[model samples]
Target: MRVPRFCCFLLLAIAASAYADSEIPFAAFELADSTDFTTNAEKNLWLLAEAAATAGDTAGNTQRASLDLRWEASLNRQWRAGFSDRVDGHFSQDLKQSDSLNTLREAWLSYRLTPQTLFDAGRINTRYGVALGYNPTDFLGRGTVRSASSADPEMLRSNRLGNAMIRVQRFWDRAALSAIWSPKISSKPATSSTSLDWGASNPRNRLLLSGSYRLAENLNPQLLLLQEEQRSPQFGANFSRVLSRQVLVYAEWAGGRQPLAWQEALPRQQWQVRWRNRTAAGVTWTGENQLSLRLEGHYNGLADNSRALAYLSAAAGSGGGQNTTPVVTEWVAPRRAALLQAYWADIFDRYDLNIIWQRDMQRGQNLGFAEVRHHIGPVDLALQWQKVFRLSTHSRVLAQADRRWQLSIGYFF
Candidate 1:
């Protein structure tokens, strides 16, 4: 019996090493095959440049660009190095010249532990989104320089973790857990008004809990519960299945706090449901012009009173990309009470779209957007436009409609 147990342990150790080897090889293969990340072994570097222009009302911004470079070094299967340099050419007419080289996007070690658990400790990039897609809905973007430029972004933890933590993942298992508890935040405020930035985040504990289970063949269910600021984000559930070879369906509903304030961590108390179907994962899985459709609706609990006006007002004046801002700027509250309701109707599968709808306790809002994108060979082209209108206000009557458009061309080799 003792001999048999020892042999089993040895076999398991070998299997774990094999699994680690598999991941690094696939990454390397994709790098060499034309998915980007490939370069001469000596000077392994690549450059990326992007520019966007937007117009609306009496304001228009143009000529925003970024100089991105990546250094890929694979030091065996267990050790890999990646350095990402981002020089922000934030030239939007009024903005100052903002350009600099950032830290290592990924400089870590991947040690196999029992062919399932992986110990990845360093400044690494992580994705909490589904299918690892670029859509913000699939997974939220935390450390994106472009996304943070938004007038009102969520209070988020930095993208990279400084402390050491272990992640044990089993692919295609009945269930899986991907969680992180880190000493990353420097501070913790009591509520939104006292929230701190990622660097100085309240020392209060924060985490994201996501798990999925296989109920049956053609039926997979998933749940995401996050405690960014509040105790736990509202709950969301998703189910996937096949109707036929041509039709697939995904329907999901989520209820949780609004993760806008770091200190107060107000709960939005809203529910959202969406259904989407596409031919395949990437663009054109079956035909030349394969299309995807998606519809999502949200119901926010503003029973306590809608403070969106004040919150947004503070966000507009909020500055400093690396620091946190107070959630409550003015001691003002709306007079009316209503539940916010809105939805999105979307198509154009490639790179998809981001349509946001905002409302108050009494009435709903409608935001408009249109986008077109195509990737031919190694070049990509994209065009997009967005319009937003603030609906039903008690203190402030109504804000002006805002529109933004962007046209971009990118080359990858």
Candidate 2:
């Protein structure tokens, strides 16, 4: 398998230097095996072909070994640096060279201009929003995914590339302000496993300004303004309140003039722009027994299910040929959806249970995921199950598997 040799060497050098100073870097290794049962969607030849072209084979088993490393150090008293990286190797009957992937999730340096002021430069994973399932205000995470190993939203968000940017922030007793600028680097995404695909993360010059104020002991509200090249500026807000020690509610919203989702997926389509809003609101409750439950709702005003299905139908009818540009299936956000999650930590002495269920309110599709994990010292063992229903003719083919099962064991060092 091809590895990013130079990047690996640089990381090792950094780790060695950190160790020389008597600091230990965090590291973990994990091995996982997964089996998938796929449903036959061949009733629609076009959709079947499209799914094959974009989603790859959905019915198979694979084993993977992964290493995750993270390090943070203080360089003198005013400056600091941090790095995060992950590497994965997949082994299976159908494994390909590209299946081995390495991601430099974050590498940045920060300078504390004052006790409450800081400046940061380099690739940084700047995440915003306060929702469990969907994040409407995460403007910088549009197309940054390089490899996906799981359908869990938390895993997906943690395993993606970060954008290269310069940021400045200042903090007060009960308020904070920040600004960021990320410049366009490459014009197209890199396809090689070892290439640092900057285009996927920073496709356009962007600027973001955000501020937050604490209005009460349990209420802090954040406001944001984002501008990107060749696009209308978007406005965003996040608010959360704690009703008591056991309950909390939160909401995130973003709005801007944008084209329809389907129009952005298909090529040469007439582009129309209008004010659109996306929102996610959720509430979580935790009990004394250590069981936490959450409920969330999402809305996407730009998503047009009818238009999306029509475009797929037209492409299928035209026999777009195998060489036809692969349709963008990742744009399949439901116009309305709901998510439910449950977590019981230390249900047993050392076991944890986590469950998630999401429904596409508009099309009546459903997705369910559950996991049980056991911890033993520095080792963890986990089993995961996922299933999807009523998604045969939908554009969300990535999650089209009928069922999937995964077992993983991890060790920490």
Candidate 3:
């Protein structure tokens, strides 16, 4: 279970940060359901398991299982603390790289410096890792935010070690700036589970700087930028409008650099766009039901290349400050070098679903994927399935799919 230990730790802490409550039945507990905590000594728990067909390479079956504890408590009005712990494992063909499983995800603390300002510095989740919480003010969508870190051995920000410097936030007033510093924590060289392992990945530091501004009573615009030393600079922005009290619409654009021809000497570039809609479907016993529909497309001209950075940039890469990494030639797209993707989703008070399709011109590949999630009481459950029908660059058959299931039980004191 190549579970990133630090990230597992964080998730567990989140699951553990529950308020006291009735104990769950042993049957349900064993089924990997969550159990909320009611006391300081007691904590909530989350368990997840997903079975897959045609996963990875083995051409057989695959599975993922994990347990997490989440918690949140007030030290006082001016101070609050949070803790999360996660433990997970994966199983597949006894391949040395993919066979074993293990990880410990999170451990963090957040303190309020003022009503409008605060500080979070610790082994925190970096902004460069996931797009989910990066919105600064609020995020009304389903599914996790993707990060370049995914191509690295690390799945996402998970745990690792570093400080996260966050500034002011205005959820209701209408503006925000959020920055994160995410660096690879691999003690040794590692390969990504989903990318081509061209040997030890070019380790580097990654940074993200994002801001949101309210331009009109109904419109809000956001700008985000990310840079990885020796690799390339990534820039993106989103414009969201409140169509009504209950309806919100958005447009987003993102671009990343790729190495050029000999310029392959230089990093190539990648780009994507999105249109989104969000609405409310009333509230459940647990939380608000925020629904969203999004259409997105992506293009990558940087896929193939063989240059390595002598060092990666640590400025944004190191977390929030200065950092660096060895330069490595990032992936480059063939002469055609263009990829496109589309997706749609529906979210309701206790359930959500998403559908996606993608096509790559240069590589001549098409892919499809879907995800579903269910929430009950303090318990959150999710199911995800993905299939890639065709790909020209890779040797393995493009037709493949994986099923993933997750459960999280949380309560706050």
TM-score-better candidate, 1 vs 3: 1
Minimal lDDT window, size 10, model 1: 10-19
Candidate 1 deviates by what RMSD? Answer: 12.3
Please write out the lDDT profile of model 1 over residues 63-115, one tens digit for every residue.
55645555555577655455544443445566664443232233445554545
Q: What TM-score fits each model?
A: 0.55, 0.80, 0.50
Total colliding residue pairs, candidate 3: 97
Give Cα-based local distance difference scores for all models.
Answer: 0.37, 0.66, 0.34
lDDT of 3: 0.34
Instruction: Report backbone clashes per prediction.
Output: 19, 0, 97
User: How do these models rank on TM-score, best leading?
Assistant: 2, 1, 3
lDDT per residue for candidate 3 within 277-369, as digits (tens), equals 221111101112222233333332332222211112222343521211122212221222212212111144445454444444444654444
In candidate 3, stretches whose alpha carbon ends up further than 4 angstroms from where it belongs are: 1-57, 92-100, 126-174, 179-207, 225-235, 244-248, 254-293, 301-353, 371-384, 389-413
Query: If both were scored by lDDT, which would come out higher, candidate 1 or candidate 3?
Result: 1
Cα RMSD for predicted model 2? 11.6
Q: Name the better of 2 and 3 by lDDT.
A: 2
- In terms of lDDT, model 2 sits at 0.66
User: Which of the predicted structures, 2 or 3, would earn the higher TM-score when compared with the native?
Assistant: 2
lDDT of 2 by residue, 1-413 (tens): 00122122122111111111111111100000010111122211101000011122354666777777655657889988877777777666465532667788788999999999999999887778757667788899876777766566666666688999999999999998999999999857776867788978887999999999889776778999999998899999988776876676788999999887557644534778889999999887767665667899999877766566666656555664222222333435678999998876667776767788999888787877787877665456777777653223324342354567777776544
